[model samples]
Target: MPHFKLNYFDIRGFGEPSRMIFHYAGQDFEDRRWAREQWPEIKPKLVGGKFTGKFTASDTGASPWLEVDGERIYQSVAIARYLGNLFCLAGKDGMENAQIDAMIDSYKDYLNDARAFFWVKSGMGQGNLEELKTKFDEASKRFFTFLQKRIEKVGSGFIASKISWGDFFLADGIKTTMNFDEEFEKKFPKMVEYKNFIFSQPKIKEYIEKRPESVF
Candidate 1:
């Protein structure tokens, strides 16, 4: 087995899903994190600065990188998928895998579009909360609606009537979206159940109950 090392900030941001996947797989990994204040120095050593392309980032050069055999693998989605294959979290067939991938892409697109307003712009950067709220609602509603139909067709599991890496994507996503509005779950009970189901895994529950808390 390949030894694993993951590098990211000391927050849930984009790293938690991979972490959750690791725990769900009952695999141990090196979880390296730095405080936000250390980003400036770290960035230059990794990407977008002095090091530039030496170490890759998610999609561009952000973080939450996975290391194997002294080689770095960038991007959280791929990391999760890799672990999924090792842990039996992958779909039974190619078609199911494609479906899961599509969901992952949809959520990532939402993040790219809303990052400015919801994260850096609105409350902090330059975007406004009002606009962020509107965008957040639109994305959340669309995802939840899509998920509802999917669950109805699949029966129980998040996709393909079984648990898969796709569950981790939405497990984190539903929680993150719910942060935008406390009552968000009230509108989609099935979605709430989905979130609850993912977190209910014994290993995942243990991790959540004992993992060090961070502000992200």
Candidate 2:
């Protein structure tokens, strides 16, 4: 097995799914984190140094990268998919892989909607609470409804009859959105059940219970 090392800031952000992947596979890897204040010193060491202008102080390097041996690989989705393949959890074959990708992409779109509202509107301190909440609800259901329909066809516990990287993505999204609105479990029971199924995995359950809580 190749030595794995994941480097990112000390927060959960995008790097978390990779961590979940590692733990799910029961693979041991380095989870390296840097303090937020240390970025001024760390930015210079990234592949593209900040002074070159190609990378910025705020830039997160191929974050949640999967460092094999000593070579650093970037891109969060690629890393997750690679890890999924390595662990034999990506999918049974090509068609299932496409299904997993579609599910993940939809989750990403759903997440982006909430992210835009929070970062662009809430961060600016201008947005109507009622209107935004309504929008958020619609966005959540639109994606969750799709997931529920698929899971209904796929059967219980695992999507597509077995675990896949898409499960990790959905699990992560559920945790994120629930923080915003806990009522999601009540609103979307099937999606909540899907989240529960992933969390119920022995390795994942252990990691979630033991892992340190961090703010994204």
Candidate 3:
């Protein structure tokens, strides 16, 4: 196995899915998080290096990047898909994989919508607290309903019948979103169950417990 090097900030943003993927796959990798202040020095090298690239940060360029086996890989989704394929985490066959992809897409859309409303618009006067609450309430309800149905259909207690990249994606999404409030969890009991189920996985639990708590 190549030494998987994940580079990002300490926050559980982009690199988290990759970390969970590798952990669920029982793969060993290094999680490297840089402080915001350190980016000035590091950004230049990343831009000037062989895999020169830039991503948007605050409307400019700040992308989550990764380097696998000494080669650079940009974009969080691409990294997740690549790792999923490499580790047989995409599911069993073509149809199954496509289903996994659809689920991933759906989850991404949910996150994007939430980001836009909560992080971008809520406090900017573009929308008020009621508006934000309404948006989140609707989105979360829809997500919870869909996930509950999916789990029932699959009958496996997972988004996919077998473990796939979507599982990790959902796990991370559940963990992050649940930070909002108890009401969110109450409104989405299935999701809460799903999240707990993923966390209970031996490997995932080990990773969470053993992971360093220091802000990187």
Compare the candidates by lDDT and give the number of the best one.
Answer: 1
lDDT of each: 0.77, 0.76, 0.72
lDDT per residue as tens, model 3, 58-130: 1224546667767778878788889989998777788877877787787777776666455533243365655
Using all chains and alpha carbons, the TM-scores for the candidates as numbered come to: 0.87, 0.84, 0.81
* Residue-by-residue lDDT tens digits, candidate 2, 61-120: 335556799776787778888899899887887888998888888888887767645544
**Displacement of the residue 90 alpha carbon in candidate 1, Å:** 0.9
Residue ranges of candidate 2 with Cα displaced over 4 Å: 44-62, 118-128
Candidate 3: where are CA atoms >4 Å away? 40-60, 116-127, 212-216
Better of 2 and 3 by lDDT: 2
Candidate 2 overall lDDT versus native: 0.76
User: What shift in Å separates residue 148 of candidate 3 from its native position after superposition?
Assistant: 1.9
Candidate 3 — worst ten consecutive residues by lDDT sum? Answer: 51-60
- Backbone clashes for every candidate come to 4, 0, 4
Top candidate, metric TM-score: 1
The better candidate by lDDT, 1 or 3, is: 1
Residue 176's lDDT within candidate 3 is 69
